[model samples]
Target: AAARNQEKRMVADVKRKEQAVAERILENDEYAQVQEEIERQHRAYEKKFQDSLGRHASEERNRQILITKTTDKVDLIDTTGRGVRPFEPSQVTTIRDHSFGLGHNPRKSGKLLDDVIDMVRDKPE
Candidate 1:
């Protein structure tokens, strides 16, 4: 009878240890996920900060820049004197045609669907 009781106690102890270990593993996994989320947010914020700084620098430099869109037509000037002249008509053979007047460059313009719809509706309907 004593031996049986001893075996019962040993089994109970093993089960308790197993439960504790499982709980610890779950907690560790949760902590890892939280840590990864924090790191991703940190990287996003860092990239945003860098982009803002670059824009600010460019804005500052653009103040005194001089640029001419049509070389023979007129001279364009910005603050930094680094303004670029628009290519002549003869040099504009690779012009992009936008279904909507969003602009030639889709990536740079980033016009949304809603904006395009609005523009179309605003046209002579």
Candidate 2:
């Protein structure tokens, strides 16, 4: 009877130790993930701050930062300067000929679904 009791206590002790280790590992992983997310947010905020300062250069990119996108043409405006400093309007550029208003690269889009539909339609009645 004493030997059986000793064996039971040993098993319980092992299980308790394993549970503790698992809990510790899970807690550390959660902490690491939270830290990584915080860093990502910080980086994004930093980029926004830099872009705001640069996009408005000396004369504020000549205040011509109005990006236009219509059915026929799509225009994109950007400052040709980098870093965390304001630049002159000469450093700003525009891309009025972008995309040419044509959507997609015209490459077998949804080919799988079309083929499946074709197979069903070709079945003999």
Candidate 3:
């Protein structure tokens, strides 16, 4: 009877060891999965950053080209004292100085703008 109990105890100990090993393997697999996820997220972020940088560079290049074209047009006008109009559509830039009125209110500015009816009706005789 004592030998049978001893054998039963040994079997239980073996099963416990196998269960512990299985749990360790599962923990390792979970850690690996987490690591892989983190790496994938990092790679995705890097790719996004690179794509944005490329887009930003392209926009800057296009801006530079536009600035160059506008500058060339101005230079062409400066050489001609009277500013002759080109056969192609001319680019006319009119710069008007803007002033903020002493009692200017943005909310009412749109409503207070010159209306045709208001101007004709208030005409003094």
Q: Whole-model Cα lDDT per candidate? A: 0.57, 0.55, 0.56
Over the stretch 22-98, how does candidate 2's per-residue lDDT look in tens digits? 99999999999999999999999999888878745634554333322212122433355564675433223222233
Cα-lDDT of candidate 2: 0.55
> Candidate 1: lDDT of 49?
78
Using all chains and alpha carbons, the TM-scores for the candidates as numbered come to 0.45, 0.43, 0.47
Q: What is candidate 3's CA lDDT for residue 62? A: 71
Question: What are the per-model numbers of colliding residue pairs?
Answer: 16, 0, 0
lDDT of 3: 0.56
What candidate 1 gets wrong by more than 4 Å, as runs, is: 55-125
User: To one decimal, what is the Cα RMSD in angstroms of model 1 from the true structure?
Assistant: 11.6
lDDT of 3 by residue, 21-64 (tens): 99999999999999999999999999987886897777876766
Q: Report the lDDT tens digits of candidate 1 across residue range 3-77.
A: 999999999999999999999999999999999999999999999878868967677545423222222233332
In model 3, which residue pairs have backbone atoms overlapping below 3 Å?
Answer: none
lDDT of 1: 0.57
Highest lDDT scorer: 1
Winner by lDDT between candidate 2 and candidate 1 = 1
The best-first sequence of candidates by TM-score reads 3, 1, 2
